[model samples]
Target chain A: MIETKNLRFSYNGMEVLKGVDFKGEKGEFIGILGPNGAGKTTFLRCLAGILDCRGVFVRGKPLNEYSPRDLARIVAYVPQRVEPSFLTVFDTVLLGRRPYMGLTPSDSDIKTVEEALKRLGIEHLSLKRTNEISGGELQKVSIARALAQEPQILLMDEPTNNLDLRSQLEVMRLARELANDGKTVVTVMHDVNLALRFAKRFLFMKDGKKMADGGLEVLNERLFEEVYGVKVEIGEIGGVLVVVPI
Target chain B: MPMDYEAYTRRKAFIGLILFLSLLVVSLFSLSSGPYHVPLREVLGILFGGGTKDDRLVVLSIRLPRIVAGILVGASMGIAGAVLQGYLRNPLATPFTMGVSNGSMFGASLAIILGAGYSLNSGQVFLNNPYAVVLFAFLGAISATLVILALARLRGLSPEAIVLAGVAMSSLYVALTTLVQYFANEVQLSAMIYWSFGNLARATWRENAIMGVSFILVFFYFILKRWDLNASTLGDDIAKSVGVNIERERLVGTLLSAFITSVTVAFVGVIGFIGLIAPHSMRLIAGGDYRSLIPLSALAGALLLVSADTMARLIVSPMNLPVGVITSFLGAPTFIYLLVKMEGRR
Candidate 1:
């Protein structure tokens, strides 16, 4: 579980998160939807403890009190884009276990990495250099790396970017399964339908403030118009609610 | 798609064995090489204390110390370069990039010009008070590294900032060294110039022992931090996400690298190219894993420098060319070849 109250962050004297408040629980799939400059990434980074902020808590403990290693044990974050390096897919995934590993990787560490790769269906490319992989495969590799952490909370920024339709569905399905298995999943997404289909809890942000929070009941054409300045028709497709922007 | 971890381990072991053997051959060749050629048989004989006095003197007193100096200095530079490149995540990072060489050169030049008047009780001023030059060199290097670190701290420890600070500090030290050179007398100027040429000929048994001990200590320290280095190469943000204390690790790693480089430079002037080329060469052979890359770079560096120093001795025979000169000639071409080969691969 994670909680934040009055969390404020600033850069160059400009406030990005203006006294924002949030609460998340285990086994919950949460999607954050926002327009440009809605402070979505900054909020996620604060929750992941990547940026220093006040009034952020994880499992009833203040985020600042946790050491980096201790925080890594409970939370994993995948950034928007990772630069390709000389590391192999296996090694990149294995780096996720760095907090738990010794000078050399233990047998269990390697096993965990292998399992993460398998879970992401990327075991076939484990030995390939990260630079030699395709964009979609690299995205999965980054996810696999975060999965190797085996954390209670997962934070992903634009996880579906560069992925094909099938891969996107597969990744969303995987996130659903992970939440069903009792892991907290927090993702910042631009695809409204994908978020609606996969995520059970929705949070809409506007101008660095939380505009709405809850289930499907919180979403409406009026809220969409206010947040995104776009008129949208909400309809059901295959018994799933879909938002169509006009 | 499972990895054959056993096979991978065996292959790395094989490569390590071959490198160790190559280093052995080069070491033996270096032992047997000099202005006065001591035969391989005599070199071996002297090792077990059964050679003639002249052969023993040549092999043990002169060539042995020089060979050890080359190995220590080369090994330190190689590992230091590897650590810097990995920690900074920059291929161009080398030991001298932190201003260690320039700082040591300034210190050595200062001692050469100023301490020429200082005498010792033994009446052998140069040998008896060698510590004056080495101490100054060590202080100079440490102070310059500290200044670079301070600037880096002020600038958020960004790679570009650290590099810029180091370059500025390096220019400052070099300018100060030139000032010393301008004010030097004839003997002091030549002595200072010879010191900067980076010859192992000045190696003494005591100095070799000191360097050997430092090399072993620093090598083990780096090996212990190999995992951190691997995580660091992924960039600082990811390194932090993976639980690495990026700032602490970067500071400590850079300081250790500068320390090793300073000690080597203090002892053996300013050897060029070994630090810059050794890690790149090893990365070409091995992958980017720091565990294998660090030790492999050490062996490769020791091999390259020993062989180059041998050529420096034999190129014009009795009049020895500075080993530094030979290294630049050999290293630059090899580096260019690697770059072209890498580009071709892409």
Candidate 2:
């Protein structure tokens, strides 16, 4: 649903994204894996249309050509860390419906927000202000907001950060379910094992470049060491692949 | 279905009602509060054209317009402060943070020293060249906004830097005002000091109409953009993700806030603390949802300022204290108590 050809971005004079190419299709759950400053977040922001960059296309249209409202209707992004403010969890989630709302929220908008919260298992916290919630709950609030957006394409940066083991799995499972339900889901992740557990495709990045792109075959000791500068033993536990650093 | 969304919304609605009713109550109380002390029944009777001519004069001609000015200036400052704080993401921000009040002060002081001074006698005050003072005060307020706008446009200041620039601008305006005061003789200096005392009594029906129009137009504009403001408090990425053009909205919101504040301050002089207290108080009582906040703050602002002005009139009887002084007296302690409560919660 979205593709980029030679996408380049820079902050000041320092180039952060160096001609990275990517194409995401419907029903594809792709995990972008890289260490610190792999241009992962930058690439996700470019796809999300938060940054002004050329050569990024959504459904064959230039990203910059779409108005913010039109683009938001089709593409929703969940950032790495969503700040906790004085907003109730329900209202914060209702913000996702903004692209489709008039001045006042409609009944459908409110219903969708409630359903989104339920999906994230945060329905009980709906009345609670975000500042009163925990880190993991806040992250789910962010994801719930994105889910409420009802976008065709979802881009998440570190969707699992600040989440506990169970919440992380639940969120990753939700992303996978979204992909399976005919939406394109792309997440930039730090935990290789968690990505392997749910994400169907993996895109490895390093030094502002795409290091490898594929499934399990793309992952090996050499690439892991070269990309993450670590020695890892990739093994199976309970028929699921897990990356353990030795 | 599992959530208590109905209860939450109902609670907010209730809060809005209380604020609205309290504002009405305080306004009526202020009407009967001045030197003549019109009774509440006579005040209502005056409204229906059944009171004494003397009572009618005291209630309608003198007090009604001042109450209207209180509502106008107070609501204007309140919403302006709320919008400013939201757009800038700075809790410390008010229209005053951008040097609006100080700039008006500087302008009025300059006018007075330059021969626009009027005599203060027999517990009455007048601006001999009122138009000149208003024009200069407005120009001064707009100048502060322009300088800050230029800083953002030309140099691309971060929101934090813009707030700092506002503080520096305020320092500059204060220094310039003091310099103006330095050159003033005794009468001119006292006039300048009195001019700094925020006076709702200065508003006749004409001034009230202008202030009312400005507040209504600006209030509607911000209310229409409340969702974007809610997204704004979360920061840029999410705000953009939600289809808000944060930059454009920020600029427009800032300009409008500065515009409304300038229009009010030019007529009423510098009313401190109403702007700061109203918005923050509403935020604490009802969370900072701009949907509720924008209106709630307006009510709270009107309620706070009119009450402060009334107390200023009633405290010494016959002689009036500066409304700004009363606002500071009410605002500082209340704000401190809120901060302590907020921090204690954590």
Candidate 3:
């Protein structure tokens, strides 16, 4: 489980996260929804221990108590855009085993990378240079790299930012599958409808504070207007919550 | 399964590196086999067992030490380049860009012009003491690193800031070196000029031994930290998430590479472009995996310099041209070719 209490962060005297409390249990698929500049990235960074914050706790332990390697073992993070200059897909995915391997990677480490590539359906691109591949392929390769780490919790920051609709749906489906396989997933999403379709819980943020944190049923038109400051049409479609802009 | 793509690639790279190293050895043997006519058997005998006194003196004292120096210096500079390029995620970054070459040249030239070695009671001038040259060179490199770091801090540690500061410091150091040369005596001026062009003729057995040991030590140090270096290329935030202590790793890597560059420059003058070009070539062939790229770059670098040095000697006969001139002559066209190829591919 990962948890944060009274988390506050400020940059250049402007607060980005203000006294936020959040938690995620094992195998939970939590989708974070926010307008632009709502501190979603900052929250994820703080959770991954990439940013210094006022209060953050992971598995009932203080964030500072865990070393970088230990945190990496527990939580794997896939950034939005991973622009590797000249690495091959195989090598980039193999980097996920860095925390486990020493100078040379072991056969088991190689196995893990192979499994990740297979899981992401990028086995054919193992030898392709990362820079030469398409953006969508790179996105999957990045996720494969995170999966190779074998972390209990995964954090993705706008994973589908540059991807087209098909790639976005593919990534979303993969995230859902990862959650179904007993890995906790916390993803930042800009598409409210997509988040409502797949995520079991929703975290809505506005002006550096949590506006609402609950199931899709709790996300009504009033909450959307309050958080996003725009009228949104909320309805049920085939037993799934559908959120659309008015 | 599927030929284990990673293993296959690594095996191919390893074999290619071995082939390159063997070629380098052949070049080293050929270096000694010019108009003087040292037989291959005799060269081999001299290398392993003790040969005739004349053969031993010629091969061991004159050629072998220089060849060893070339290999070590080449490998050091090459690996330094690979590390820098990997760290900055830019193909153009090398130790020279960090002002290491210019600063070391300035320090050595100052020592020469001021007669620091003569005042220290050394029969040979030009700061012949290895320790003194290494110390001064290290100081110069470290100062440049600090200045670059200070500039980078101003811009929140962007690669552009560090690169811009490095370029500024390199220009400043070059200007200072030229100033020192302008005021130098005839002998000091010639010495500075020759040193700037670079040579392996001063490679004594003692110097070769020191360089060999230092190169091995630093090479292994980087090999151990290869993962951190790879992570760093992904940027600081991503690196941190992947369990890397970015600042510490960067500090260690930069210091070790600076030390290697300083040592090489102190002994061999500024052998331009090997550090900058060799790693880029290796990256083109082997991709950006440091575990493979670093070792391959070292071998490729050794092969290139040894061959270039051989050409420098044989091309001009007794009037051996500077190795640096030959390297630049070869490296520039290859670099341009690569640039064109990259553009064409894009």
TM-score against truth, every candidate: 0.93, 0.97, 0.92
Model 3 Cα lDDT, one tens digit per residue, B153-247: 56456665666778889999999988988888767776566557778876788878888898999999888878887887777766777788886
Better of 1 and 3 by DockQ: 3
Candidate 3 lands at a TM-score of 0.92
What ranking of all candidate models by TM-score puts the best one first?
2, 1, 3
Our model 1 lands, by Cα RMSD against the true structure, at: 3.0
lDDT of 3 at A174: 84
**Chain B alone: TM-score in each candidate?**
0.92, 0.95, 0.89
Best by TM-score: 2
TM-score of chain A of 1: 0.98
Interface RMSD (Å) of model 2? 1.2
Clashing pairs in 2: none
Question: 1 or 3: which has the higher lDDT?
Answer: 1
Q: Candidate 2, what DockQ?
A: 0.72
Per-residue alpha-carbon lDDT of model 1 for A1-246, expressed as tens digits?
999999899987899998888998999999999998999999999998888789899999999999999999899988888766666788889989988877878889999999999988999887666767888898998899899998999999989999999999999999999999999999999999999999999989987899899998888899999989999999998899999999
- Sort by DockQ, top down from the best: 2, 3, 1
Q: For candidate 3, list the clashing residue pairs, or say none.
A: none
Native contacts recovered by model 1:
0.44
Per-prediction share of native contacts kept = 0.44, 0.70, 0.72
